[model samples]
Target: MLHSKSILSFVLVLFISGCSSVVLPIDERALINDIKAKYQGEILAPEDLKKGDITTYSFPPVWGFNVRSYFSRDGSFSLDREFYRFKNEDRGSTIFEHFIESEGDIEKTGRQIILKNRIAYRKYDSSSDLNYLSTFKECEFKLGTCTYKSASGKDKKVKTYFENGVWTSEYEGFRNSKLIETKIYHKSGLLIFSSYKGLIRGNTSYSNREAFEANSL
Candidate 1:
């Protein structure tokens, strides 16, 4: 009877161990492929791309713009795209204006879609966190020279404009009703020049422009 009880207890221990060791199967490659196919664009794999694990993609022109895609362990993911204009051209590229093109979770449910969420567009005067102007939105998308605004209520207005050979964005609600504006000039998706304007507290204005000449040293 003692031997029989010892065998029964050992079996029970094995059973419990087996149950605890169970792990859900995860196919990281499958998830990455699905995301690539849906976007229909070449996604530059991150430097840390590994097998059977979470990965990130950083697409180019790697300067002045950033588009990052993150794949999580739970099969969930998010894509964030941003554009920046240079501020300190004297010492090379520095961020002056930052624009969030799109940022949201990409869920796979027969069809992949970026979940609608509140996103803000911010413009800064320097490298600091002093945002001079901002715009709020529920959803915004760029299609060629046009942007579709699906954000409802007061923030539903579209404020970006593309004219001739330049793209301009403006914001007007920050720090005592200050106004901020930025203009971007690019060729082949590379920034060539950018300019900024902002209103100060004493009803004065501040502005700067940085140009990147091709033949300049």
Candidate 2:
């Protein structure tokens, strides 16, 4: 028994709500600089990086794994997969490498350094497989936000933003071209709430002390 005007108004309200939920991309380099500024002294030295480990728990239906990250004195880092095994031990096994500020004009702000370009290479087998390379443009201390060009030359844009104590990062570049977003709400550098959507979906929250306990480092 709704009138025509009432139906039109309802449709308009739904349209506005949909628009509000859309995530707009931001400046890639600016976002990386912001993250580096916030975590200036947290960068790991070569010796200190060897001592720490990062363990991430995947929700049910997804297998979990441990990550051992090694940082070099030259501002480069590589992540090795702890569980992956290969018949030929000599074959490359590194998941990815982040070469920060090693190729171009290095820019320094105080003791902190901002990386302009980074190159990441996936696991390669010299006996058979071709080395997959993804070139990163405008990278910061770590892999915060940047443009990634795949081996095939397709570009994928990534950006992270903070609002109301929650940091959200969106990556738009999978095979299906779906937007994958992750939101992390933290306190005192510990995760309080974390959620993932678009492709992989899960939501988890924790208390301050619980967050610290969850960290394996």
Candidate 3:
């Protein structure tokens, strides 16, 4: 699963960028508590669920500086990520550093939860085989925010909440925006799930969040 993330990051290094949105800073602890309080239905314990009783579960992100949560369920995880873009004279789409903001991910498998966020900046070169230059920054949660070291030597922080097992995030991509992609996920118990990614925002998002393993933090 991590490999897929790596491959995606690698490919985006070849793209360019645009303008971004205003993302506020968030507290990880406060955010987790809010999720637990709001989406209690999806996190049913064994004692709470009888045999044949259909139940779903998804945990809130734990304390500390991580965006990932733990454990399993019948709930789903929906993610909306942004990548910067640039258009060339030939009408080719590229991602450049000066464009704006990009990066984010949230996923759960078995009992492990992982949070991934990276801002990739590429320098466009039309005459070169590799049209873009490689420059990237992976942000980590700290002090209630995701801190990123920008290409200009400035520290930037961006925060998006993962509530009720749904992650709806926005990125202000390229100055002249054309398209944006978003992914919706539906996970059944035992990790069986379906995902759809597209340019238009999805309306299939559900807010049924839960945690199956009662004691599994």
Candidate 4:
């Protein structure tokens, strides 16, 4: 049940994955590793870019890959202006992800993923739309943390972990902050997985500490 756009994406991924000289091979692990090496520090000023810092990084591809940095120094990524935000290269620019520290507190422990569909998935399907000018649906997380859900029927809360610039068990789904019925991943700098909810519809294997691949979902 892949959408037309999703199908096209699949084909493109196949093409890139099949290419031998594509540098990073259309997968998540390589991209995550690249991102981890680049921004893993603290933010000194408004323009300072640090690893884990929520700054925008542009890539040299047609479907440009972008990043919004974060780290343990800044605390966590959130929907607030001072936390995190990101964008994709739909306007012929490589400015894919953007981040900023807001004046709010993140009380959870999962990663905030800013997706191309402009959705933020926290845990349990808590997806929401981005505001475009100041608040988009996509974002990034460094060692950042946020509020998440635990297993409960009426009232339950649990702390997800976002340390070392990666979400240990967070899964990105649609526009809901609720964890999807599907599995998610820190796939790459620009991609994520909806495996847990049966989106990919294939059995996958982990790649590095970030990405994964499956022949069936």
User: Model 3 over residues 97-129: C-alpha lDDT tens digits?
Assistant: 122112433222112111111111233333333
Sort by TM-score, best first: what order? 1, 2, 4, 3
Q: lDDT tens string, model 4, 1-217? A: 1111111011112212111211211344444454455433421221221344333443322221122221213323211221222324443222323223234332322334343322233322235443322111222332234333323322332223443444433443333233311112332233332211112212122112122121121
What are the models' TM-scores?
0.27, 0.26, 0.20, 0.24
Candidate 3, residue 206: the lDDT equals: 21
User: What C-alpha lDDT values do all the predictions have?
Assistant: 0.28, 0.28, 0.25, 0.28
The sequence of per-residue lDDT tens digits that candidate 1 reaches over residues 1-217 is 0000000011111111111221112332232233334333322221212232422222132232222222223433232333343323222222233334433432211211111111122433333342212232321223123333332333333356554334455444444343433333222123223333333342223222322111110
Q: Whole-model lDDT for model 2 versus the true structure?
A: 0.28
TM-score of 3: 0.20
Query: What's the count of clashing pairs in each model shown?
Result: 0, 0, 27, 49
Tell me, what's the RMSD of every candidate?
25.0, 19.7, 20.1, 17.4
Clashes, model 2: 0
For candidate 4, which ten residues in a row score worst on lDDT?
Answer: 1-10
Residue-level lDDT tens digits of model 2 in 1-217: 0001100011111111111232212222233344344535542222322344432212111111222221222323232211111112122222221112323332221221111111223333323333323133332112356766655677766666554334455554444433433332221122222333332122111101001111111
Score candidate 1 by TM-score against the native.
0.27
Looking at candidate 2, what is the lDDT of residue 184?
29
What candidate 2 gets wrong by more than 4 Å, as runs, is 1-82, 85-121, 128-145, 161-168, 173-178, 181-196, 199-217
Q: After superposition, how far is residue 101 of candidate 3 from its true place, in Å?
A: 30
